[model samples]
Target: MADVTHASNAPPAHLAAGTPPILELVNIAKYFPGVIANENVSLNVFPGEIHALLGENGAGKSTLMNVVTGLYQPDAGEIIIDGYGTTFPAPDAAIAAGIGMVHQHFRLVPRFTVAENLHLGWSETPRRLSGKDIEERASALSKKFGLPITPSAVVSSLSAGEQQRVEILRVLSRGARLLILDEPTAVLSPVEVGELFSALRRFRSEGGAVVIISHKLDEIMALADRVSVLRQGRLVGTHQTCDVTPDSLVTEMIGRPVTLATSYPRQSPAPAGGEAEPLSLKQVTVRDAAGVVRLDDVSLALRPGEVLGIAGVTGNGQPELAEVLTGLKAAESGTVYLNGKAANRADPAMFAHAGVGHVPEDRLKRALMPGLSVAENMALREYDRPPIGGRFSFSMAQARKFAQMLADRAGVKLPGTQVQIRGLSGGNQQRLVLEREIRIASHVLVASYPSRGLDIGAISAMRDMLARARDAGVAVVLMSEDLDEIFALSDRIAVLYAGRLMGVMDRADADRESIGALMSGRNLSEAA
Candidate 1:
C-alpha cells in the first residue's frame, strides 16, 4: 500500500510550515444545492513544490478547484495568496492574484496560430497581427523552457501536449506565479507525460508553484512534494511526498485499501463455441491529409475465447484503427472479416449483427448521445434488433425493458431510464457505454479505453466483464493507454507505435517496464 499519513475521524489542518505558503486554503466550504461539496477543507502549497491533489471522481476535487479558480464561489472559506486571505468573485480576480488554471478539456481556438493564441487576451496594443514581437516572445519562452513549440505553428496543428504548453505559457507570460493543472496527463501520450514532468520540474526549480490534480498514483509518487488526499468531500490527510509510495497513495485515494492484481491469470479460459472464427483484419491502411499514412499494412486475426490487446501511444493511428474496426471511419485500403465473411464499410449497423461490439474511446464524441435520455442512448444499440423491434417501427415495451436491464447491469446511478446521459457523471456515462456494447455484441468485442472515465469499482467491474466474456467464448479486442488495464484484461498484447504494429507478446511475458519501453518504440529492449 502507498505509505500515507491517514487523517483521523476529525479532519486535520494543514501541516506545520516554515516559510509562508504561496497558496493556502483555510476551512474551505462549498455547497451546491442539496450537495455539500467540500466541508472545511484546508490545503497549503509552498513555492518550488509540486502539490498533488488526490481524489476519486465526485470526491469534491473538481468542486474545490472550481472554487479556487473562481468558477464558483465557496459558501464559506478563506483563500490566502502569498499571505493575505482573499475571496474571488471572478476569474479576473484570481488572475490578478497570480493564479491560473488549466481545465482537463482543451479550450484553444483551432483556427488560431500559436502566436495569435498567446496574445488573444493581452491588453497591449499591436497594430500588426502575428507580429515579430509576438513571435520573438513565444519563441524565446519556448527555448528557455525547452518547450519545442513553434511560434508560427497553427493551433490546430499542435498535439495535445503542445497545446497544453501553450496554455501554460500563456498564463506564465502574464506574470502568473501559481498554476493549477487538472488532470493534465489524461490526454497525453507516455512520451508527452515524461516531457511534461520534466517541464514541471524546471518550472518548480524556477520557484513557481504548481498543483496537479490527478488520479495517476505513479505520477504523484514521482513528482509531488506534498500530497493531499480527499474522499467524499472531506480532507483525508496530507503527507510529505517522499513518505508515500504508489501503493499507499492508491489505498488512501480509494478510501479502503486495495490490492491491485498484477498479470495473474486465474481459471483456464473456457472452450470457444462451434468452429466459428471471430475477427480478421486484412491489409488495413488508413491515410490522412498530406498523404500521411495513419495505419499501414495492419492485419490481424483472433479466435473466440481470446482477448487480443492493442497497446499504443495516443495518436499513432490507434483511433484510426478503432474507427475501421468499429465501422465509424473507413479504411483507405483492406477489409474486415467477421465470422469468415467480408464486411462492407457501409455503416456501424453491421457490427451489432456481425457480433462485433465496439466501445469507442471518445465517449462524448462517438459512443453516447449526451443530450438523449439514458434509455434512448442505450436503445441506440438495440433499435435495429428484434426485442426492441423494427421492421419499420418501434416496440415501446421491449425498448423500455432492454434499457432498464442495461442501466441496472451497468450500475448507472441516474434518476431513472429517462434521465439524460448528460446528467450522469463521467464514470456513469462510461459504464453505460460498456453495458450497451457488452450486452449486444455477438462474437467479437472491440473496447477502446472502456474504463477511461470509470472509478476503481467501475473499472474492476468492467475488467470482470471482459474476463467473463473470454470465459463465454467471446473474442475481445481491447485497446488502452492504461498499462494495468491492458495487463489485467488482455491475454495477448500487440504494440503499436507510429502506426506500425511492433509485435505481439504473451501477457505473461509483458511487464510494466517492458511495455513502457515498447510504447517508446524500443521494441527490441522491451522484448529482451
Candidate 2:
C-alpha cells in the first residue's frame, strides 16, 4: 500500500463552512476475477468545482468512475448525492439522479442531426417531436451553457471540437447537476481547448459540479479546483488545486520521481543540403473510398536524422498523409519517392522491404493482433526470415526468447511471452509496437499519436525512444495533436488543414500561437 491518508466524511477545508459536497464516495471497493480494481477509495466533489482525477493507466480511475456512472456496481461502498445515500442500478438511473458522463469517444450518431442526437434515449422527450421543436430546445441549452452548435447540422460534418460540444450539451440537457468528462481535450486544438475551458467555467459559475479525467498535468493544473490522485486501486490524497503542484501530483500518481522532458536535446543536427531525401512526396493527392479528397497537393521531404513533426487538428488529413507515406494507400495523383525513385503505387510489403516502419494511429485495429501471444505479435514483422521461422518450420522457443529480450529492453511489463497481447495495458502494447518498429526501421519511420493515451512515465519513455531512433539516422514523420510533443521532438513542423499543407516551419521559428493559427487553417500572414 502507498503512504496515503484516507479521506474522512468531514467536509473539505476549502469549501464553505456548511456547504456539503454534491457527490461523495465512501470507501469504494471493486473487485474482479483475480484483480482488485479499487479498494477503500473515497472522494468528494463539491458544487461548482472542477475536480481532476489523476492516475496512470490501469490505476482504477476508470473503475471508480464506472461505479459512479452505474456502468459497474461496487463490491462495497456508499454513493451519496446531496447528503442522501443511493444505489445506481444502471447508467440511466444515475443520469436521472442528476449525474451525467461524457465519454472520450463521442456517443453521438454521426449521420443524425444535432437535435436528433440530443433527443436519443431521452425519456422525458415525446416520441414524436417536430424538428423545429427539438432544434429550439437544443439551441436554448447550447446558449445557456455557452456551447455554440448548429442544431440542424449533421454530426458527421462537424469538427472534432464541435462534436465534443454536442456531447457535453447532450449530458447537460438531461438535467444533470454533476458532469463527468473523460479526456475531453484529447483531440481539440489549443484555441478549442480555451473555448472548452471557458464553457466549463460558465457551468461552474452556474453551480454545476465537474469531474475531469485527464493525463495532461498542465491542463489539470490550469482547470481544476481540486485534484485527487489514485494509485494501484487506492486514493492517495485529495487536495485543493491551490495547495498542490504538478510535481507533487506526479510523485503521488507514479510513486517515484520522474522528470518529464519538455524538449529533447538532439544528439546531432540533421544532415544538411545535398543529402538525398529518404522519403519525399511531390504534389501528392489522395482520396478515400467514397472519392473524397483527403490530401491535396501536399509536398514534403524527410531528411536523414530528423524528426519532421506533422501537426493538425483531427480529421484534417493526418491519417491520409500517413497512409500515403507508409504505402497503405496510393496517391491518386502526383508521386511518392523513396530515395529519389518514384514509388507511387508501392504496396505495404514494398514499403516494408524498403525499410519503412509505421506506428499507426489505431494500434489495436491496425498494428497488433490482440488474440495472439505477445511473442507472436512482437515477431510479426520478421517472422518469415528469422531464427523463429524457417521455410517450413516455426521455432516457438526462439520467438519467446526474442520477445523476452525486446520486452526487457523496452521496459514492457507483462507476465510472460505466452500471455495474450490484449491482456497488456495500452502503454505496454505501444512500447512493444515502438520497439519492433524501431528495430525494423533503418531509414524511415512514420508514427502517429504515439503517446496519446499513455501516462506521464510512459510518455517520457516513448519520447526518449523516438529521440533515440532519430539519433540512429531514421527519418521520422511524427504526426501528433500534442504541440508539446511536436515542439520537443520536431526539427521542422508541418501544419495541415482541410487536406492542404498550410505551411512548414523550423522549430526555432515556430511557437504555439503560430502553430495554432496554422492548425485552424490560417496562413502565417493571416495569423500575424
User: By lDDT, who's the top model here?
Assistant: 2
Whole-model lDDT for model 1 versus the true structure?
A: 0.77
lDDT of 1 by residue, 385-405 (tens): 787867798777777678888
> Model 2 has how many clashing residue pairs?
0
Per-residue C-alpha lDDT of model 2 across residues 143-221, encoded as one tens digit per residue? 8777999999999888879999999989898889999998888778778999999999889888899999998888988
Clashing pairs in 2: none
The C-alpha stretches of model 2 lying farther than 4 A from their native spots are 1-14, 33-35, 130-137, 262-276, 287-294, 312-316, 362-409, 415-426, 495-528
What is the alpha-carbon RMSD of candidate 1 to the true structure? Answer: 4.2
TM-score of 1: 0.85
Q: lDDT of each structure?
A: 0.77, 0.87
Give candidate 1's error at residue 299 in angstroms.
1.7
lDDT of 2 at 395: 85
